[model samples]
Target: MATFPLEPVHDTFRAIATTVVPEAVALDRAGWERLEEIIAEALASRPERIHRQLRLFVRIVDWRARWRHRERFVDLDPLQRTRELERIERSRWLLLRRGLWGLRTLIFMGYYAQPAIQREIGYRARPEGWDAVRGAGR
Candidate 1:
């Protein structure tokens, strides 16, 4: 069976459009219109592709958030509190800490990385072709 990240991509693109369009509208009506046109065209042509891109973008943002939080924990010197501990005790603490870090990294990478990888696979599997036009601006 084949699976796609269409849902994730759709959500991510919607998030980005929601966040960015407001700012664009504040620029000027013409600018807003132009942005709207671009968005409309993208949505009309390859909605699924845009959605996939958005999902990847969201995953990247989420990973960055996690990394920032992890940095805060590291800055707190979480390992320093265990000084003067026995070898076995220190080993156990280290194992647990390493396990947590590994798990976090895996999750972050898995969520963000798989979409792009899958997208490439999908693209190669089913390449997009040019659309046929029935009339000239009819």
Candidate 2:
């Protein structure tokens, strides 16, 4: 199983929240502390399944960014990026299909909260387009 770093996830959330709610970010430290408390309380009420979905969401974004900039950063052949994106999409679909409320929450968050991230990172090619690559199971 793959895991994502928590700080980056949190930072991403903060960035999204700040963009969506500028007043929240404009607050002083004490105000931000209270906002954090509220957000924590809300998240605590959700099931653990949400965390799994969140992890997948973060991973997909990270992978998509890498894939989009593959030429600039590393020597990922077209085949390699295709295989990796397929793996990530499979994981995301599985979580979306089988996980519980947490998964649902994650989907909702992704739908609403992910536009900026997706805009920044760009989208992967559709799975079918990637199917021609070896190791990207149809």
Candidate 3:
């Protein structure tokens, strides 16, 4: 059985990811599964420092949820989760704010890297004029 990198915080991270990038919440089941695989792959490629930071971020989010609303981040209702995340995004502590930004960045990176999203955004691996430019030099 393969274990996920963020197993302990998977649900919390998924909620945060979908909340931060609302478009991701629109993904179908297959798309969501693909997103999970992409995130797991990215996490496996990173250094331990990044892995630790992500885990710590989940803990902080959970702690904040309990402190503010008496529930775990993953257990909160959608509105409450959104409110809590927004609060953290606006937190006075720079570290917490930055951490949330980092998490958002990772989520966005993985979400947008998918082929479907890439095409939707008109991102092509090779532009139409690339061959013309390359052949011109050749």
Better of 1 and 3 by lDDT: 3
Q: RMSD of model 1, in Å?
A: 16.8
**Rank by lDDT (best first):** 3, 2, 1
In order, candidate lDDTs are 0.36, 0.45, 0.81
Q: Hey, what RMSD does candidate 3 come out at?
A: 4.0
Model 1: per-residue Cα lDDT over 1-138, one tens digit each? 123333344333333333322222133445333433444443455557644554454455334334645432112222321121112234556643443343233233333233343474463332333332323236
Among all candidates shown, the one with the greatest TM-score: 3
TM-score of each: 0.25, 0.38, 0.76
The order by descending TM-score is: 3, 2, 1
User: Which stretches of candidate 1 lie above 4 Å from their native place?
Assistant: 1-37, 69-138
Residue range with the least summed lDDT across 10 consecutive positions in model 1: 80-89
- Give model 3's TM-score versus the native structure: 0.76
User: For all candidates, what are the clash counts?
Assistant: 1, 1, 0
Error of 2 at 43 (Å): 2.1
